[model samples]
Target chain A: MDDPLMLARVQFALTAGTHFLFVALTLGLATLVALTQTRATLSGSAVAERMTRFWGQLYVINYAVGIVTGLVMEFQFGLNWSGMSRVVGEVIGAPLAMETVVAFFVESTFLGLWIFGWDRLNRWVHLGLIWVVAATAYFSAYFILVANGFLQRPVGFTMVDGQARLTDLGALLTNPTALLAFGHVVFGGLLTAGFFMAAVSGYHLFRRTAEADLFRRSMRTGLVAVVVSVMPVAAFGGMQYAYIQPTKHPGAQESAAQVAQFEARFGPGDYTPPGLATAGEVLMEVAWSLMFFLAFAMLVKLPFGRWLERGRVFHVLMMAALPLPYVAMISGWVFREVGRQPWMVYGVLKTEDALSDVGAGAVAVSFTVFTVLFAALVVVNVWLLARFARRGPEAVRLGAPGAPEPERPALTPTF
Target chain B: MQTLALVVLAVLTAGYLVLAGADIGMGMLLPVLGRDGRERRLVIAAFAPFFLANEVWLVAVAGVVAGAFPGLEHALLSGLFPVFVALVAGWVVRDAGLWLRGRVDAAAWRAVCDGAIVAGSWALALSWGAVLGTVLVGGSRVEDGVNAGTVLGLPLALVFAAHGAGFARWRLASGLAERARRVPGRYWVSGAALAALPVAAGARLPWSQVVSSPEALAVTAVMCVLMVPLLAAAQALVWWTFRGRAESPGYL
Candidate 1:
């Protein structure tokens, strides 16, 4: 508990985990929102447009915290893990930098345009902005995974004067670990979005809200999203376990030689990850199995959309199932990150060696601050999402034509 | 490549200061610019559409630093760990406040979020000033010793506040703009403050000693070359789209 390394690790886990919670939804919903908007533009359906605004508002709210949490994640690397930067930063830095340039920069700008450009710009242009935002969002995820992939299975870099230098850009970008993980993450995002939409729409249907038609259509969309994405999510997770895990972790088939090579190069240490890695993997698998069964059940209802909408039991089940994808995604993330234990950059840099020269006290303070803040954010984010979800599309103000002004006081206060 | 990286870093930093600085400043004066909850919402709406785009400039700066000058990222961020922590905390709080303020239609919720915005904005402005001051006075290493540059943090924060006021005067409706006018200084001061931050910070760092390997730098620079123009174009679109004065409260 007193060790700075342990504290730093916990802090990273909590903060990064919280950030991923928002990001999973952001990536998925951004795509959904873009698709909905595209349909609205092409068909000129007011229902689709309202759907876009409704979902888009939630996306923005989630994204707001995601961006800030991401900033903290970036800062954590330099603040608590400077040693990794001092060593292998050159290799991973390129993809990370490209991410900011290509994704963060473009995504934010386009989203801003998309948000404020409604009714002001040409309809086609406004629609184009969302697609751009969605594309850039994926690009952002890809670049980040590339960097994380480097840590999982370092390649295309050579050690020189105690620092890893980039030798092959192509090899670094196409690291199979990154590509596979990318698929898993993207599918996981879609699954999360599917459940979120279904849960929200299900709640409305259970209560027989005035917008039954709207909720029904969204319910269908949500179910379709789940049916399409869940299989891929499971498949990708299986692929990673089958293909990537054995190569990275010791005690797995064909991993003895790599373990031996590591021991010889870095001198004797525990080398193997702790038991928690297996625990996380098991938890993830269990969650996935549960989601798979639930998804299948939902698939059965898809053909009978009318019965499904009125089924209070199904709505309750959906609301209950809302947390499944979140749980699975986090557990899967835990497995991936924790499974690579002892090494911050597997085989290249030990976790202990990558810590910054900060005191235990400072790390503790930061750990406490970040945890509390993130927890508060998560609470508030969920509360807001739930509140808005309950209110339904009637409350959506995003891109509303001539939004009413806030009530001004009789006398404005002087500056 | 090194020069290009440095140039990109400079441009991004300056862009953040000039663009995002206005919103941060506006956040600092959120209460003053708008009296009641309704007024405050308006003040926030004035900058809402542009804030996300503006903040990304800082993200870009951090990216450039980490990617092209890992040594600098390691040295600067860790050397001034406490300051960075405060800055990040402020950033998180401020953003959370802005994003969540209007989501719920409760007076208390908005009030609390507003308080977070003001406090977080001030914290961001002051901590950024501290970072700059620490570098200026302490050179490459940020020591605990108080110096002239350290003392300068407060005044720099005020500069940010004034920059926000100037921005408010320009973007707000006529009634709110008049209220903002009392603070004095308009776009010129804002521009000067924006241009000054990067130059001051740039002068303090030993750029030659902090650059990464040539290959990494070259790759990063090429990326910047490809993306910066697109960033510029998209940013111009945002500014153009919202060119008119903020008339109604935007989605927060």
Candidate 2:
């Protein structure tokens, strides 16, 4: 752990893992809230309006933390892995710079308008702001994956005077690895958000809270979202397995050829991923399969989720399942990142070569500081989320300009 | 084109420093100016919206640096790795604290968040100043390598603190405003006096060979000199435009 290389890897794993938790939620919830508000605008239903505010409130909570965590993620490139930055700064940094100049500004600016412009803007304009936020969020994710894709499988770049330079911008954006990875991540994000809403609403309805009608409706929406999203999520994961797996573990004959080639080019580095990463990949697949089955069961067996509406065991199950998708997502990320070890930019810059000329003590100290700070942040994030979630939607301040006053309670205590 | 890019980058950096300084000042002033939690909230709310917008300049500056001068950025960031990490951490913690403060109702939790804000703000101010000191003293010349603390560190921090206090003085009102006004008077004078160290240090370098274009350097220097009065005018205009007593709106 004291070794700078190991410490740096640990730091990246901790920061990226923690950062992904927030990102997954932000990506998924942003889409869901947009859907709720869009539906509310079209049908003008009171329940839909309440749904928007309630979930939107939670979305804001998650998004605020996500933005900060992301800032830290961006800095680590320069601070921890200066070698990677210097080698690929011309190529990878292009997308990141674009992410800031184009995607971030759009999402952040519109999000502000959508948040504070509640009473100021026209309703349609307000709705548009959210869609912009959602679009830009996904767009930002795309450019980021484009950069990451290059790392997974280097493309459209040439070594010029000891630096990787962009030779074809089009190929970089159109890289198959990045597109597949983007699909897997985006759909996975939706799945995470869907299950989260279902589980939270399930908890409320199970307790027979005063907002049963609202919770029941919310649970149904979540269930639908889960059912819809699981297909694309599975499809994309399958696509990745087919595309990325063989490259990692080539057939015995090809493996020999590849190893010899790699050794000739860049001597004495392990090209193979650790055995545990394969196990994690398997765990991710197994967990995703289970999620699919659960979604199907909820949709068909429950029939409008009426069965799940009242059963104590079912609510407990839903609540229990909340952390599973998160687990799967994290395992999948770990597998992906760790799979490409030894090379920070796969075949170009070795991880050892990419490190800054800093002392081991410096890396260790920074790692400790970041870990403690991140842990504290996660605690605050989870506490606020749980507290607000249990409080129900009435606790949501619903009186923004165009927002309607509270309707008479629709929830009847059926239990 | 390279010179032009460098000049643009310099302006962007200056923009971030001035804008973000005031924002950090708001957080730093929380413990100092706020008599209680309510007053603290008022101080935070006074600049929270603007803080988010001001922070964008940070992202933009970084983006421009990476895009425009990849080599320089590489050397600077790697050479100053420890400080960069600390600065990044400071930014993360500060953002979390400020945003999270308004979300909860618990007194203990609020206090924790406030502590995060104070610590983060101070770290950012100090680290940023230290970076300036490093650059001003010449990147490779400092004796302690990457870990060496620069002479400009304290002065830069003080100058930024003064900038923040000035913003708060103009933007906030009553007790908070009065306290904020005193911060610059306390720190800015000394900071200004100490600012000569970096200039004198930089004079030791072969100044003519610093960049390829002497005109660009001359223009930048003139711009740098012009910034002080320009910043003063800009702040004065903003204060007058939003002037009067500082009152926290119920919504913000």
Candidate 3:
């Protein structure tokens, strides 16, 4: 704890993990919200519109914190891990920059339009903005994964003058390490959204809210989303373990030669990952197994809508089960990231070497500040989400009619 | 490629200063601009829609620095670690306040959030000016202690507040606009402050020395070239859509 390197590492883990919690839900809910809005636009269904507004409100609330945390995540690299930038930045930086341009820039702009465009723009154009937002949200995640994948697998780069440089864009983008994880993450997001929707709807039904029909449709959508997405999440996750891990990980079956090469090149060191990596893997697998069974139960209940709605026990179970996907997803992330331990860029840049030249005190201060702030923000976020969720669709002001626009006075020529 | 990268970086930095600066400034002056809770909510609604988009320019600037000028990114960020820390903390608090202020319908909750907005905004504005001051005096290394430019940070923060007041003057309606108008040099102050950021940055950093490989630079530069125009169009659309004054409080 006194060591700056350890402190920095812990800080990164905590901050990034918290940020991912928001991102997972944001990515999933963005898609769900866009789809709901699309249904409303095409069919002109009032229920669908209300659903869009409701879900959209939740999405926006989550996204609000997500954006701020993301800003922290961006600055963190330069703040604590400058050596990573100085060494391999030529390789990974390209994708990160592309992410900023292709995803965040576009995503924010379109999202603003979508938020404020309510009754202002053409209905189709407004709908298109949301789809753009969702697509770009995935793109943002993809590019980030591309950069991270390079760190995990060290592909499409060649060492020049002791610094990594991009040798092939295609190789970087298509690295199975990145692509497979991207798939896993995307489906993981959907599953999370499915569970979140189901849980929120379940809470409403459990309470015997007046908006029973609205929640019933939402509940069905959530359950069906889970059924469709859960298997793919498992499949992609399985492929990553079966295929990518063996080739890239130090202790895995196929990477013995690579491990030997690393040992010879870097001299004596504990090149193997920590025990926490294995624990993360085990935890993730356990959570996923439980979620799979729960998903199966949901699928079974799908055929009998009225019975499912009336089963207060099931609703309570769903509300209880809400944390499963979160646990699975986070643990899975920990498994993947922590498993790459001791190497900031696997086999290329050692973790300690990647740290910025900061003192333990400074790093500790930052660590405490960020961790506390994130925790507070998360608490506030969940509280607000619960409050809004309980209030249901009627409380949504996302697309609600506003007071009349105030007349603009003539601009005083002040320049 | 390096020049193109620098141009992209310059553009993004200036854009953030001009756009996000206003909102941060407005946040800083929330109490002065709006007298009561309802009035403060109105004050926030004026800039809420544009805040997300405005802030992304700073994100883009960070991206450009990390991608194009990797060495500088490492040096500048780690060197001024404390400043960036404060800036980021303020950013988080201010944004949270803005997002959460209207969620709950309690006077105390809104007040707490409003206080967060004020304190966070001030922190952000001051830290940003300090960043410029530190960089201007070549305090790009931790060893470089306080200098003249560091002191200049105070006045620079004031400039941002003035810039924000200018924005409020433009975007607000009736008494709020009148309140903002009491600040001297509305549009002129805002324009000068916006123009000053890039100029100061340009004067301090040696752009040519810090660039990445041409291949890497070219890739990012190309993406920026392709997307910037689209970004501009969308940004214009947002400005156009919300061109009118704050008629009522928005979905804060």
True contacts kept of 3: 0.65
On DockQ, who's better, 1 or 3? 1
Mind giving the per-residue lDDT tens digits that candidate 3 earns over A83-158?
Answer: 9998998788999998998899989988988886787789999999999999999999999999998988888888
In order, candidate lDDTs are 0.85, 0.71, 0.85
For every candidate in turn, the CA RMSD to the true structure comes to 2.0, 7.6, 3.4
Task: For residues A1-415, write the lDDT of model 2, one tens digit per residue.
Answer: 7799888888888888887888898999999999989999999999888989999988988887788777877777777777776677767766676676566755775676576556556789889879989998998899889889888888887887687777777788888888998998898898899889989998898889898877887888787878888989878877876546333553446556766778898776677666667667888888888898888777774465566578777687788889878988998887787777656777788788887667798888888988898788788789989988999887774324212212222212122
Assess the local accuracy of residue A64 in candidate 2 as a C-alpha lDDT between 0 and 100.
77
> Between which residue pairs do clashes occur in model 2?
none
Candidate 2 C-alpha error for residue A160, in Å: 2.3
* Model 1 DockQ class: medium
In terms of TM-score, the best-performing candidate is 1
Tens digits of lDDT, candidate 2, B34-93 = 666666766775666456556765775666555544555556666777777778888888
Write down the worst ten-residue block by lDDT for model 3 chain A. Answer: A406-415
Residue A14 miss distance in model 2 (angstroms): 1.0
